[model samples]
Target chain A: MTPDPAAASAPGVLVTGAAEEEVLAAVVVALRRLCAGGAELHLRAPPVLDASVADRAGYSTSFPHLLGAVSRGGAATDLVLTPAACYHVYPLFEGRVLAAPAEVSVLADCHRQEATTERGRLRSFRMFETVRLGGAEDCLAWRDDRLDRLGHWMEALGLPAERRPANDPFWGRPGRLLASAQRADRLKWELSADVADGVRQAVVSVNHHKEHFGAAFGIRTADGEPAHTACLGVGLERLLLALHHAHGPTQERWPTHVRDALGLTRSCTN
Target chain B: MTPDPAAASAPGVLVTGAAEEEVLAAVVVALRRLCAGGAELHLRAPPVLDASVADRAGYSTSFPHLLGAVSRGGAATDLVLTPAACYHVYPLFEGRVLAAPAEVSVLADCHRQEATTERGRLRSFRMFETVRLGGAEDCLAWRDDRLDRLGHWMEALGLPAERRPANDPFWGRPGRLLASAQRADRLKWELSADVADGVRQAVVSVNHHKEHFGAAFGIRTADGEPAHTACLGVGLERLLLALHHAHGPTQERWPTHVRDALGLTRSCTN
Candidate 1:
């Protein structure tokens, strides 16, 4: 359910899927359309597994430990391009926080059950009230937070998001905090309803857990919630795989839009 | 010219190089030495250039049509990896056949010229050869064309090379040919003495290129006409760079063997 480019005129869809084959298939279809529409394409590096986790996986048998540990044992475990940082958003819980209003009733019902009776227990969570945006901005500064700016950016682009208080699972609870904000940062923008519709369709076929094993989950958008609360994750390696599938394996045929998005066009020799 | 690894075995020097910074640096010092021996390291990647001539440049912004381009119009170009064919070992020239002796001589001289040329010129030349080694039994039947057993296995390993002579300027000549081969269709290997020393050093760098390039170049040892003839190379992205340099922009510490050979292990990782 990819959004129609004609309706939203959004930059091409950036998808992160479970397997290389699945993502590659989607990229091929997107590339065919983009080529026909004269859009540029770019491929970003794939999302890698956390380095610490890779070391624990014992991936050194097939390849040299120095090489195999870094190359495999992660999300974007291919042997082509170098690894780059891309933020994977996840809810960070500290204490207790509000649930989306729509989930209140359901959550209340679940909370009423005894811990031993329920399949899962309800837990209290806390999140940063605001997040930072751009360079060097602190998370407390709402003005600089992408979540706050997303509405305006979408509106400026003629794709206004419905504003409403909602829970941000990412940064809303205690999980893993990224070492550097840049590696955890992403550009958050509103998806047009038309585009959202397409995303919903595509999401049906995509396995939510496949993108980022324990970090990624889906949120239901209620009738009055933001048009859609999507975290535009930037998995560097996943992006590369997508691009490889969209365009040919060669970098020459990459779409211009994608190249520009990643700033790969900046001349750098191998 | 490449230093003889077998001769330097007691001192056991492995020289390697690549067209990448991290890879070159990483190859010199890995976290662990899979194979124990001292290695002399020479790290070199083609420098980034805006423009250059067809024969001497290593990189370019335009789609190079001649002299085996590495970058095509700002995109990295794919080098063809050929399988070890009988024709590669004995090249045909002007209705005459040049046996192993002539083939080896032609390749050696070409390598020397390419190595002595300006750095830019060396970059422009796409001189490489590859060979696939499987189980001892499979390697024995490599000469049989009917059963592409080795070639098929290499392709299965993700390297898809053809069992024919390459069509590069270095190998396309009537009397001259570049002896390039690969273990898998994707695992590209070359036989050259020009940057053989640099190549061998790169393997020891523990850099990313060791795996990314999977390139190993060497000259036959039976009749070493060229004094400094034997060398091996790996890729720039496949080596482990973290082990070679310290926590700065420069290399701070190289491995003990590399330190002794290059006399600079205390460099930064910059």
Candidate 2:
């Protein structure tokens, strides 16, 4: 499991255990099942994003101050570290027409320069994401299905989680309005659980980008309409923290409900 | 599974299916078993490392031109994105005395600015590392045990792998000498496999730092002797590429032996 980035005592260090390994495995398998048979591939978005593309995608407008940039043969503002996992997928589909809705999943560490560094508020965090792209209605339906499936999985795992309207940590005064609008439009929903030290945090999210990415990347549906996109992502470290709070420091002492949900086997460990 | 960074056909992307999930899970469990029931905890190193630490760790000496620095607060060179997964462990042990031999494991993405973007050389790649710190003789023994265990895992997975003396892509003429010395001392041993496009690449490395890390970080063993350290790490993306090369593109089509070693169960995926 990933470590708490904000915990000053343990900031930016990962410590994993047997139960953590099991949960990580269980999470990956469950997410794959939700992908509806995705062809697994690996991706690493250029750690630095193209400033112009990010600008078109509302990155600089949303959080101009938080970008982590590199001096890699571009203007100072030409590139910034990617802020989101799904963003990279859109670029790959640039100018492409989908034959059908495609589902892709990624397990990668995302970076952000946040104002807060509280334990668990990681600067770089591990995430397992399932991203679906296609028709507007199909994407929406898939999002709904996944949201429901995630709820069921967590319930079986004995992780007390609640899905509620949420907003990204967008920046500044303008960001406040954007956040509120996002909440009002119900563009995002997070499955939040109590984590280390009884602090509440969002462990999973179901996000719909409507036509933002499709228009920005010039991606279209099979019928030549702007593609709709929805992404479901689980914060691996946060999930482990929630499990630790619920089951104890490790998985060995986890309750039968939790253990059953993880569905661990002897082959998984002794 | 992640793709090769250098491969233009699938640059900077990771994809996985049910079988791949099983493989990753299997690898983790296998590694843990090799740890001989490591009573160790997981740690997450801060993603952004202090530039001075990287400098002192001989990163600048090794690759002077390929550093990824952040323009966020402080001077241009004060901080940088972490380039190696094991570097973080050494700093944490600074000014500390180990009661006994200690071992830690990390699963994190390491950054490098590779001049050549080959299909298999990822600029930002994920690494799973096991770092052992203790007496010179004990650490060496542990390192030997790990190297042998790794060989067995690769064979069991049906990957034709060979261990050979290796050198880092050190920079310039002076760095060339360093690389030669490293190989001469048998400091770095890589398990090479034929990956993407039948190119032989390194997937695992067992590195013995001797007292380098201990001396740099001021870490002393129980008897006040500078500790010796060794790191065993797997480049997950490269391994995945090798698996794809040998087992075919989709994990579903992989051989029974491959699937079995992954310990795939219906419970893991239907």
Among these predicted structures, which one has the highest DockQ? 2
- Poorly placed runs, candidate 1 (over 4 Å): A1-137, A140-233, A237-251, A266-270, B1-249, B252-270
Candidate 1 at A210: error in angstroms?
Answer: 28
Clashes of each: 105, 32
Assess candidate 1 and give its TM-score to the true structure.
Answer: 0.23
Candidate 1 structure quality by residue, lDDT tens digits, A1-270: 121111211112111212332333333333223221221111211112233332222222212211211111112221111111111112111111213211000000000111121111111100111111111122123222334443343233233334332221222123124212322343222222222222210000000111121212222222222211122222222234334434555654556655443333444222
Model 1 docking grade:
incorrect
Looking at candidate 1 chain B, the ten consecutive residues that score lowest on lDDT are B103-112
lDDT of 2 by residue, B1-270 (tens): 232323322234333334554566566655656653573656545455766778778786678666667664322534566677777667667777888888877665666666665666766666778899889888878878888888888887779789998988888899899899999988889999988665788899988888888888788987887889988989877888888888787777778777666665334232
Report the CA-based lDDT of candidate 2 relative to the real structure: 0.70
In terms of TM-score, which candidate is strongest?
Answer: 2
